[model samples]
Target: MTIEIGWKLDNSYVNNLPELFFTKVNPTPVSSPKMVILNYPLIRYLGLNVQTLQSNEGVAIFAGNKIPEGAMPLAQAYAGHQFGHFTMLGDGRAVLIGEQITPLGERYDIQLKGSGRTPYSRGGDGRAALGPMLREYIISEAMHNFGIPTTRSLAVVTTGESIARETRLPGAILARVASSHLRVGTFQYAAKWGTVEDIRILSDYTIKRHFSYIEDDENPYLSLLKEVIKRQAALIAKWQLIGFIHGVMNTDNMTISGETIDYGPCAFMDTYDPATVFSSIDIHGRYAYGNQPNIAAWNLARFAETLLPLLDENQERGVKLAQDAISDFGKLYHRNWLTGMRAKLGIFNEESEDGSLVEDLLNIMQKYRADYTNTFVALTFEKLEDSSLFSTDEFLKWHRRWKDRLSRQQESNNSSQQLMKNSNPSIIPRNHRVEEALEAAVKQGDYSVLERLLDALSNPYDYSIKQADYSTPPEPSDRPYRTFCGT
Candidate 1:
């Protein structure tokens, strides 16, 4: 089938680029290729000819069996501090095909995840299980609906092969899209292995691609560091406000594009506990819900270290500049978190005691172990006396204070209800529900549950009677929910 290939692309990483930035890799052809899903919206966004991908031959290209003419597939190299330990790591199972310039002039990386081994695969298979591949597809889309910046999935193609993990599972490839896959690890890798010139080249490339406004600044690299810090601060604050735990905050998982990357072992906290952790390997709770902001700052510090030479010629001046930028993360995250909290409380204006009022609600929530998502959802309504949510003396006391605080605002009740409804979603991808959906698809050959879940998740704020079950928290039977990296 000669599908008319309409690939408007370029390979900047391979053109006039040092070999150290990446390793040339060709994808291993699968035995049998099958189409699982295609993102029609993204297809139009990338300005691709839809006719080319609807046929069986398109599965071959998506499953990494066929490469487009202008595609230069390669595995990027990077190093990271994984759980406070420095290790050289790279794209072990992912391969970037090319940079697709959209019809609107925005550039994005099109990569195939779980497309077999590369030079970076250190004593591990590069195959991905269908469950985790689907897990990522579901979670990333949910995150997008939440208005968070994140990498998007374009397609998931089945390879008609079995992969051996904890159990033998069907293999699949995820075609992922992102502004860029460059991470803080990339800079670390360049600084550690490449010369100062290499680091400068990377800094320049990052500025040009993502932070173009600062390219002509007197200290463009320093400004770049500041901007990245601000982005990360705001991002982590948003995650905290929404009860999302990244599970793993390793430098390699932190993208310089300011988008959330790597969906492994991530979960939303059902109960409003700051120490909530779902990742099986995070025994110490280093990346817990409460510790995310600190971990993000620590990761940014490592990023700053890689920009020392580019920050300034004088070593002392550069260190001071980096420290000043890193110090702003706390103020930035606090302001961002407070702003989000104020909105969740339906307050249109800020007061000096607003922070304390927000803390009091969360304090009571944690004390009573209330459902995190439902508590805010219930606030948007007129009365809660008849519900199980406000049948406590402690909650009653706080509810009165909250109403008193709201009365001082300059907003109408209808507008405040709408704001609260928008700020607090009625539905989140609960860990137990996600597990159920994955179990049905991975073992039962049924994908209807997942499709339905995605449909319900698309409008999380809307209170639909049919989707009521998705809003409930997991019962005691689902206690101590555990997740793994699926490596």
Candidate 2:
């Protein structure tokens, strides 16, 4: 198929920022770069020419060796609350090359992360180590396969030079695509500058880009805040249903578009544990698995605070309106979450106690310490009959409750079976598998393992043809593996 693309950079968003933030650009350089992986299918999805993107010259263009003709690289300036404390942070090691408005009128950023440093590079090397790059490529693609909204990896290029962290590791660059790179922290930065005019401008611009339905609203800023809160709550709740731990739920990492960004310290649960945290820097366990929803609501509160000036004319009125909007996050999250859980359990009708139904199942999972993926897989594998398919008594009890609820479900047995099949994935990027793939590539220079894992993750819903071993967690010997931030 012929892939077509058209791009227009919307410099209008950050047009009025300080010149130093935009004009002073210095990207660190790397040597003898090699193109390790290219997302050809995604390139076609974006309607770009694969022949050009795959060429040697295209490799240079992708690796930040040379910028594309119409592309403009600029680092965004934003502030974020890291571990509950606000800090000034921006794209320190990343640069937004430009934006592309697709044929469908969807705007996406063609960003070069690990390209080099900008003014935001806060006293650290602006390069990325190979391991993290590969991990993101694997996990991000896995997320997409699982039908999650995320930043897509366009390409991964190895910079021949070595980067020093705990060990000397090869450098790499990732070409990431996103709907928009604007974050809740972006609004926080402008709000902290204490410029109401800038806040209005930012709020108006965001409304146009994301929540255009509010363009004609009387209180557009308040409407935008409400819409963002709804989106974030739904996003976080989805993460919970899938057993995903974002690992770092800092305000800066939370994007306003509601797409999950920064796969630095992220993992799927092997066992049903609410407090699972894998990031080494997250010593306080603030962004644990169970805390993601609460963190999301907290970040939305910060976003609401930023828009207080434009939310209403009266300061008191604005505070009240923003609070009202932020408060709806819980209701919206619970509503969306229960909807998703119903699909998982194949319960189409709404129950007044749906949240309790969902919680009861989770309590059982916790009590049994059941494998999250396996439980769902078994349910989808067979109907509620013969609960013995699952190995645990705790699951059997939950299965009984599930069967009772299933008797009242509106969906036919066949329909429910099909819905369950679609809702629950058979495989996710297992943490140990990802680490093993990366280690093999880095230590033995074997890319086959990485390739195989990517192939499995590319279609997580299809377990029919998959090897039986990929669906299970790693053995006990492979337990306790932790991922590090490759700065």
Candidate 3:
């Protein structure tokens, strides 16, 4: 049967860019594709026909067994610094079907992850394991619910074939939707390899697509750099405010749209530890929770390097301009992070002491090893049940100071609490719970656990009895959790 849901797909990226930016490709056909899960809410949001998309033919399209009309599958080319080591990389196993135009007239890139190998596949089979694909589906949706800018997962479909990883694993594909797949690395690729004019073309296209308002600026490329820096600073602040660790802060993973992408080894911090590292491959702890801000500044510096030619006519003047802009990253990130911290602490007005106040709370959390999410929740809801940590003299002193600070605000306690409620999520995708769900679905082929977990995570800010079940931290006796890149 032909799958026809009237997709409004267009190859805008390929149509606008030269062949150097991307290469045309198709997804490798899978054997016996089956739909594991479909994001009906997201489908409806995109104004797609949900009923038609639930059919078997739709599963084939998702699994790379069939290509739909108006879909021009291709693989994007880019380069990145992985763990500070420069390398030429691109869409090894992913295939961009086309940009989907929603009923509301918004454009989003609809890509197939783990679809197949392309020119960028570095001597490895371009197949994805079912567990990791579903993991991305679960965590990405959870991030979206938490009000973070993130790529949305449309569906996950299983391939009736095994792939060789640590052992034989079930194969799957993830249909990912994003504002655009352009990354900092894309600029890096154009800068290091292509001519100066190439960077100009890519920058102009990016500005028109994302930073359209800046097109009228005298130096639009410089404004583009500043805007990207601002967005990234704000985006990283949101991640840190919610205790999210991106695990791998590679240049390739940082989106030009400032949306969180590449959920390979990303995990939420359970305990308030600055030195948290979950990615097994991150042996040096470079992308730890505390190092995220600094790493973001570093990545932005790399991005700034790619735009030096367009920043100014004189090379020397361009370098100075880039340096000055990069220098502001610290101030930008601190302001954004401090603002978020103020909201989390229920502080309506900012003061000089606010930064130290937030720092003191974090120090107490670190000193007592308090749960990151729950500690904020306790303060937000006045749930002082955790006497083991909250009853200490140090914490009590901090709590009294916090209360005094709140009293000074003109807003009523009710208003402050509401702000805190909006800023701090009561629930995060906890590591142990995520692992349990993946274990059940991957090992036992039971998806009820995953579905229930998703339901609990659907409303992270609103506290409920069902959500409370998954809010508990892992037992102390449990082994330390580690995550893989799933390559």
Candidate 4:
């Protein structure tokens, strides 16, 4: 495949046998196409020619003003359960332009989120505000550096036009790359609106593409469910350890690939509160910090529901099998959570008291309103060397017990400190910092702050002195934190 053609002949999604999976659509031509940022690392990673990508033609293609040669643009059709209510939803503002197969032979979905109207626009203008696109770009890249599975930004382009949400804001498009655009809700859509044969076809295609090891299994659909459950268990556990709040855990946002997707209104916790909710829409705390593991299990159960017909020939047996899969979610999540928590606390060996040790530390953290990222990062430093950190009567009490537990293990202090350092990140995309970046871009049309914050976050583990201020939590003046979906 030549770089001028942009992609190889294999558009598996298009060549595949289903017209119901997507609807053919063309991206509406924009007024002026301008490049804002191109992810050089990801471009090279995907093995695309950088010289071609930065050319004027590349700018037009990315901005959705011109379709690339041999590209098949379409809007994907999928249903989602929004906020516990099942509603038919599709790509209201986004379009999947094509799937790019890397020189390494791995395929990823190349999507234009905030690219204009599709068949699924549903009475809303198909456009994106600059802030949310920028938010997704920052957080998703940060998540990747944090060693988390995530959909990443390949490029961001300006439409040189204005979009109105609450008011007139600059329009932008995020060229997002993902393992695939398939989601649990994709299966939900198939099961609800498509034939049983369609569901089976989706299951087989999913297995062949992502889980070929399970292709020969006696019950591939059931096996797929089990594997998804396992990945989600591990992923959610990582989120808990790192204090990430996805904000919206709706069905469509949950990917079947188990990678974190749809970074709308998501925030990392500053204070260690189980009930922390930053999304302005999460009024009842349904997707709160402490509830992620359980919510993941719930989402998987819905996924299993979509696979019922393919799970087994007999309905009762299928229900039982799915129930067992759902139960495994709890077991798997607990084990992964415990294993991750142990690493954060520098516990190499499992112990009966380990759970309580972890629990007590959290209790003390909540009591002290401790900054989540800083508290764990502090453990790696000299004991109490940073006296300004989470220091209190309750924290000291927990610290004595924690030290006693560590003493039982034969690992050297240096190794334990190394484990702490590796497991805990010194910085995350703090909410206040993110807000500052967005404010600069949306209001003053300044992107330098966004670039600077992205720089600090790109090396989250190193904690370089120049980026020290990025690690701090929000002050009281920034209280009552709120994030919008930017729809």
For candidate 1, lDDT tens digit of each residue in 369-476? 888888888787754653465788877898888889889988898888889888988888998889999999889978899888988998887888756889877777
Tens digit of per-residue lDDT, candidate 3, span 373-479: 99988889898986478888988898989999999989999999999999988889999999999999999999999999999999998888899888899988556
lDDT of 4 by residue, 130-199 (tens): 8899999999999999999999999888899999888898999999999888898889999888999999
Candidate 4 residue spans exceeding 4 A from truth: 1-6, 383-390
Clashes of each: 0, 1, 0, 0
Q: Between the candidate structures 2 and 4, which one is better when assessed by TM-score?
A: 4
- In model 1, which runs have C-alpha deviations exceeding 4 angstroms? 1-5, 383-389
Listed in order, each prediction's TM-score against the native is: 0.97, 0.94, 0.98, 0.97
Best by TM-score: 3
Sort by lDDT, top down from the best: 3, 1, 4, 2
Candidate closest to the true structure, highest lDDT = 3
Query: Which of the two candidates, 2 or 3, achieves a greater lDDT against the reference?
Result: 3
Candidates 3 and 4, the one with greater lDDT = 3
User: Per-residue lDDT of 1-487 in model 2, one digit per residue for the tens?
Assistant: 1122333455544464444234335355667778888898887777677787777766776778876556667888889998899998888889887776655667788888888877788987788988898888998888888777788899999988887888798889999999888898888988886478777777777788888888999878778887788778878877888889888888888888889899998888988889888888888889888888888888888888898878778999999998888889988998887898888878888778777878887877777666788778778766444333365666667678778888886678888877887888888888888888999988888889999989877777777666456877777664465667677
lDDT score for residue 475 of model 3: 88
